[model samples]
Target: MKKRICVLAMLSLCWGVTDATAAGPDLDGYVEFGGRLFDVDGDEAKFNEYRDIDNGVYGNVDILSYWEGGYYIDFLAENIAYDDQAYWLNGGRFGSLKYLLYYDEIIHNITEDALTPYDGIGSDTLVGTGETEPALWNSFDYKKEREKYGGDVEYAFENGYFVQFGASNMESSGVMPYGGTSSAEFPAPIDWEENQFNITGGYRAKKLTASLTGQFINFDNEDDSLTRDDTIGSLPPDNDVAKVLGKMVWRPEYYGSVVALNAGYSKTESDEQLGIVVPGETRNFDGEITKWHVNGSWKFEPIEDLDLKLLARYDDRDNDSTVLTTLDGNENENYSSEIFKTGIEADYKLSRNNRIDGGYHYLNKDYEGRSDSDGADDNLFFIQARNYSLEDVELRAKYSFLTRSGDYTVEPGETDEGYRSYDVADQDRNQVELEGGYYGVEDLGLDLEFTWFNADYDDTEVGLVELDHYDLYFSGTWAIQSNVNTGFYVGFERDYSEDLGDAAETTYYTYAAGLNIEAYFMAEKLRLYAGWDWAESDGKSEFDSADIIDTDEVEDFTQHILSLKGTYFIDEAWSVTLGYVYEEWDYSDDQWNNYVIVVPGSRGDTFLSGAYDDQDYEGHTGYLSVKYKF
Candidate 1:
């Protein structure tokens, strides 16, 4: 009710200003409550329905408090209450001796639409039906709220400097999912608002340090459910950004050494509404972007276990020029682009058991916005090794390489002196890894690892393909007595594919296993754990030949999981937790049998492909909390 009477009038104005400032020293904080439950199974009906409280529950409640002293006043609060009862509050603070203020608020009362299939349209329908879809009952109960307030006041001197000015006001509203309605029962356009501002300066020394800051952001969404006033015809529009930065550091103790320098610049203006089609629609003008950088490092020992090092960096960018339109308004303006980069690194310590390292990098780019005058270049390399043996064993290895080439532009008034020129694709990549370990059992333990990868691409881009990979792993652990502990692991992975217009190549593999156990009763506040996992996969494609391109069959899937977790310490301010999970999925590919369906005008919404063809899923969770400290 009126947010619990504004959190009891800010906790009675923070205890009436701490009993009229009884001379400092008094701090307090408290409050918490919780809830969560989720159960899901795959094979359609949108992936096991929960369309908002059809029995399954989701609940929560929370209220927070805080206070501090020494420099006078400080207090904070956060509130949240839900279970469809709806409530929100995010926190704020106020300071004394003159002035200082802060504020933050977020009120969300989302009417469970099964949490909108977990955002981003159920991850684009699990990348187009690799499964998961279902949950749209009524589908239009959404509420969003916002409140932001800021403050700053400065006047300090002890031998340091400070200056400040800050301001903020942000107000937001319900259901604005960018895009005109399609379906899901519309009714959400509760108006909108946004605002921001800042200014700052600082300096400190014992060696050297400095700072400066600035910011501005504003927005006014004139109804129409947040920005859509005639799509690109503007109304209460906004977009502006500005930046500046500088830094420096130097240390010299009779030339023992340290040095640093940094710089920055930025500018931006908007109102094009995000567009990029490079053949007709290309928006992002009202431009200005610039950048620069530099770096340095050094260290020395020149003895003992031996040590050495070095490093470097550089970068750049620029753009500005407008006029590009589409969405049936058609207009264009000559474009632009540019980029550059550099790098270097090193390390060594060939003793006390040996060590080595490496690095290298470079990149370049230039293109007069689309009409082709393109450019490209990239390169990298690396190496590493280490060993320490006398029987307790330990070894490691690594290798890496990368390469690239340039020139590309296709379609859109084809340029670069035309003639259909758009070929400058070349790439090569390689990687290797190896590892070994031993801890001379006294508690029993072991580990092993191996990896390899390769990639090649040249003058080809249609579905661009070429890659090879491999991996292997093994692990072990045991202490079957010290409060009990155990572990196991196994893994294998492989993938090979090549198809540059029917050069045809395919291969796939996946296998895994895991197990873990742990226990430690009373003497450790109580603890328990369990884990198990398994996985499998295999490959081929070409269905309905629309220029033949389909792969992913021979899929044998298996999954089984069981877990029970616990923690209890009902004494030092209270604590309690319990968890249980069970999972099952097994499928013998028949291309998933076209994923059974029957919910278009529901007859009790059906889609049970054998309920996951070997189904068995269950989940139960529990929590009890009570905390208090002052």
Candidate 2:
């Protein structure tokens, strides 16, 4: 709707900047109005999937103002009419000039119990009718919707120059889920558009700082292809991109050194005409790609609590597309890659609270016309330690190791004999980290964390042989007086994997948990807020030999959240707010909720869409708002 009338004309120009006159612009802002109610049982589009939060009529706006020489203004708006709306504005002058504007909206509610024997579902031509009875087909909702807007400006010069510019746009239309070829599946029809531009120039000093940048991007895909009868597929085309960037930093205070540099370049292009492949060839497919990167760093402090760093990086990619030939002689393929890195780091201080840090890294890769292996090498090492010499307690530890080697080839009927292609496979990795903190219990605060990970491919004989991960966390906070406060946190996670397929030899497992709680209360004008959250996830898969069959919990889920809010001032600036939100979800999948879409072989040859059995849901929301401040 014309972007909701340009966001209601920028909220009426930020409500006329609080009556722009008589030396106005000295406001502190608050305005809110609300109404919302929802009670969902199962799939209210999975509890408003990407939020529109049903039964509504809500409003909000926040403003900050200033105007006495260093002029300023800030505005914010949220959820005015739904679909996750947003708007923001920032105004200038504190140093020189500044400005910004923004707008955002999102909606991605997929699955409204999809089913389609197609009848132009979202149009780009789809017309299926051989409908093998899916409750007589025709019902759709696998959604998508996105919108973005932007603006920015910057200017300053007091001898530390600066200049900047910006532009942005994004749009997306609905319908998704596509895959076809005899087994069928289609809904596809998302007309996307994107555009962006940027410019920058800078210089700052206290040592030195410099910058230059230029960027441009464009993409358009108005249903590039989707014809369903004789089957035609192909979407996502039309592209263009360009970029250039440079940055530099230097500091030299007579012997204290630091230098940094960065560089970037990019190019991408795509032009249409994808028709005849190799018969009377008159070629097309003139795609292109080019990219570059560079980075450098240096830091120093030769002694006394020592600190040093040196780093380097380089990257490149080129695939100047456009290749064609056939009639038994193959062609029409392109690929490229290059990457290099070097590193050194150190930090030391042995007493007065202890500290240590270390690093070493090396990486290399080169490939051309890749088909699984061409080159690869990587190495990494790390160490870290820190202690705050007790007092209020603080500690940290870290360890890391990594190794990767590759040059394993197989092309010529590609992949299927000792496969090995986990990104050029031959891997070994290990990591560990730990952290702790305590504030000596005055108002109480504590935290703890742990992590570990491992990976090994042991000379791959088919594919991915091992992987593992684990994490744990704990937190606490308390105030108990002066207004009361509380906090809590908990987390746990684990993941494992092993794979090698020829028939069966798979093993996978995942587990997750999370818990959170927060509370706050005050008495003087009455205020309270509370929150609770819990989450869980589980997954499993196992198989052995002799024809498979050891599978059951292929991903299970659980989630819950609760929130409450209360506010009452009625004096200071007038306030009133009452809010409640609750959410619960549970899902299970052993291949998308164990089939039966009107049965008919229960989706064996595909053509099923029960919307994943409507994902369990339970939701409740309530709101009431009124606020004013100056």
Candidate 3:
């Protein structure tokens, strides 16, 4: 709605000149106010569309100020009642002539509840009625909003050299819930705008440092395609990209040797290309793309504790397109890719506490597309060891290995269920990691991490097969000396993969855990806090069809979070805070398991009823805030 009335007239002219800081602030920075409450329940748990479970009343502030002479201003706000929001405002000028201005707004609520029967939801074409037909199925919430304005400036020189420039403008409006097609994925319609410009120049010495850069970007699409609440497609056009960059770091000896260099170049195109081109097409899509890269590094310490390093990199890409025809004489084939890398690393100090490190890397890639991502070439090796002489206890170990050789090129009725053998394969990879910690109480500390990964293309004949990963983590913290402190954390992750063809064959994994605690007593002006977190994700896919037969599609989610806090001071500038937050989410999906409204036709189990069940929710939030310093 006119961008929410121009953001409510810029927040009512910035809260009508700061609403007299609610009766405070007579010059030196400081102002805050608050009131918050929220109660939520299941069903798409506000899914990010702000609304976070129907909350109410929230006003809190954190500001930075200076107002006179050195001019300054800043405001930061977070989670202000629903729609998952965060806002920021800025003002500048401090010292050696500086300048700044900024504004930000964000809102995203992906799915409060999704279900559609196409009834022109947000216009631009939508009409449904295909097979099985039963119609009337409404329930939508998939939203997005972003608005931004920017500014920047920097200048410093006394011979140390420095210069910078910046620009920005962004606008986005949306309702893209994974836009339809590939078998009916619904909800799509977005307006866009973006503009960017940049500049930089630098030189710092004490052993050299240099920089140079330039950039320009543009993308504007106020709706130009998409049609599939019923059918019609072809979108994403209106593009522009340009870049130039350079960097260098050289140390001629001020404690040794170091050299670094980086380079870049870029180009992307779209002058006018957004669709419809019937008749020996010259353009339906010939979108241009170009790229370039260069990197270099060298470090030295040929002796001493024994240290040395060197690395090199090169990359290239080009697809300056122009050959898009088909109206009886097909013509379209343009591709390119190139990459080369080299590396070497070393560090040795078998004394002090023992140490060892090693590295070797090599990569080369060249492609012409089709068959997933063409081919691949790689070789990597690593070794590590460290022992902190075990007083507070500390040890580390690491190992890595990799080998891959390509050979893939599928195109000619691309089958295997439309393959994705990216980087062809003849693979073999292995990794092991371990980290340590133990700072024998002074404040207390203990941490450990473990990881193992393996990959084998199970006798590749094209695409996926056997991949495994595992991880374990532990954390600890404690302090009782000055007031109080506490902490705990746990984590585990595992993933497995296997491949054999199309339609389905997927596996997923994720796990998380956390805990936190805080304490401070009277002498410290009172304070207490608590936190807990847990996460889960699961997935299983196994569908192989040629007209229905086998099945096994499942997706899941589980989450829980809790937080509590208390603070008191009311002196030394003032302080007051009380907060509580609780959250829960449980979700399941057999790919949008039944919600009745019928629309199945061009194949069996059309996503069970067309996905979007991301439901289940619980919420509670309470707040009272006050903090100031002026």
Candidate 4:
């Protein structure tokens, strides 16, 4: 509520900008208001609309006011009264200082129709209701809301330099679903606060620009742990982070060279004690990360009709943190990686309408722990070419191959090499891609793309052995008339994995991924769009060992969406817009078929099953809005 008041006060200040002088300042604006309706059932919850509005009254404001040079105001607000509300307001001129303020709200509706057996849904304590029947379960809606507001102030000098100061605050309050080993799944409360402050200064020049920034971030959480049927350390405590970043981009006209450098150092630490972990003497996590990178690209015309380009980049991340160990001898982990990359390419013109270019790239990666199970080092090589030899057709292709080799396999916090498993494993990967774009006609455009990826694991035991992937996409847009336009798109993707290892040497799992298509037509005053997407993925794991068990989990779903909107000009300055939208979600999973469970707990209350998160559902939205612009 305080945030809302702050926003309202800011709005009031904006309106005051027009009333500063008796002569009155120039003011122009428009307001939009509309109504919408939607219906959702208890058993049928729409997770997609968790963060967005499914049904409600909608309103917006767009305004700009100015008083010559004294003061200027601009505000663009959307969904003003809804959960997904946001606005930006910038207005202020004090001597040479300028400022802007903005606010954004994000919401997650979660399950609107959750059936639980507990009361006090939003409070800290939850008491179970003895009702065991699914029909008699208590109903609740879980949601998360984050509110962020910030302002930025900058001072500019006549000599081409500026200094900026910014501060922001974000607060989150919500409930999430979590499960426990000894108890049924339940909702947990969340109350988080994050504050950030930063200062930046930059110098601007005709051929060079540079900036440096420093920031401090603090996160505080009220609910460090949740105590319901089971007391669990469910959240991380307060933490403070500080970082400094610098960036520079330089261009030397004499050699046509461009240089870019970016570097940063960040340290994060939290000393809050967690009583659940055997009440250790030291805090669990204290980490620091340092990042640095430099990139440069140069273009030179050594000869006529020939262009040469050279590029290089170096990036590294170094992590050093105090490792806190538990009484059981368990310790924290750390990772640091570095990369070096360079590439060169050249283009030669065969004629005014033809050109060809090829490039080679190399990348080497090194990590601190070369013996970790997930692979620690990699070297990649690539060569690519493009030929623009045809008047109406252009083609481009690239291929990359790489191999990975690691030292001994081991897991962190333990010295036992026998207990380590390499899932990604020592392997070879080959990637190929081709893309083409055609824009020969003034009224038409087309794009086609293809990609193939294959990975072979040479030495793997009881893990993913090999995988193959493919993707295809085609899209085009054509102008049917000067006042009409239409476009269509289609895409398909597939991935296949084979892992058949026995006991110490075998693993098996397989699946498939899908196709998306869209078409749209727009006229001077009418627009129609439709999209359809479907995906089916089902994989199972199996081991031949008598001690091993086979597992299966399938994911299958399809979504359909259709929208039509048209605007009719009542006059040169007035218009009306009518839009209708239809959406459908279809889901089918084998494991949760008509799932319903009600178990009487050792405590007096009954435990109930959660709602099917992705059940089939359809939605329709219709709106008629009027607008006036002068």
Per-model C-alpha RMSD: 32.9, 29.2, 28.9, 5.2
The runs of at least 3 residues in candidate 4 whose Cα sits more than 4 Å from the true structure, single-residue gaps closed, are 17-29, 40-56, 65-72, 91-98, 115-120, 123-138, 180-184, 272-375, 410-424, 440-442, 499-553, 598-614
lDDT of 4 by residue, 95-166 (tens): 566888888888876666677777767665667676667678777766788999999998878787989999
Scored by lDDT, model 1 comes in at 0.53
| lDDT, ranked from best to worst | 2, 3, 4, 1
Ranking by TM-score: 4, 2, 3, 1
| Residue 289 displacement in candidate 3 (angstroms) | 25
Residue range 203-279, candidate 1, lDDT tens digits = 65656556666666666564421211122221233556566666555555533444555566656555533423232
| lDDT tens readout by residue for model 3, 1-630 | 543554454455446547656544334445566677776665543544444434455554556554556655556555443344444555545644454545566766666556666666655566764434434566666677777767677776768788888887888787765433355556667778889999988888879889898999998877656655335555566888999999999998643789999999999987444333342222355478899999898888877887788999998998877766655787756778888899999988989998999889998888774435565788999999999998999989999998887755644235552465635566888999999999986889989999999888634543576688888888988886667788888887877666653444667677888888888788888898999999887877665666644434456678989999999976778888899989888877674665544454545435333334546778777888787866
Worst 10 residues of 2 by lDDT: 275-284
Comparison by TM-score, 1 against 3, better one: 3
Task: Using TM-score as the measure, name the better of candidate 2 and candidate 4.
Answer: 4
lDDT of each: 0.53, 0.79, 0.70, 0.68
- Candidate 2 contains a number of clashing pairs equal to 0
- What's the CA RMSD of model 4 in angstroms? 5.2
Q: Between prediction 1 and prediction 2, which has the larger TM-score?
A: 2
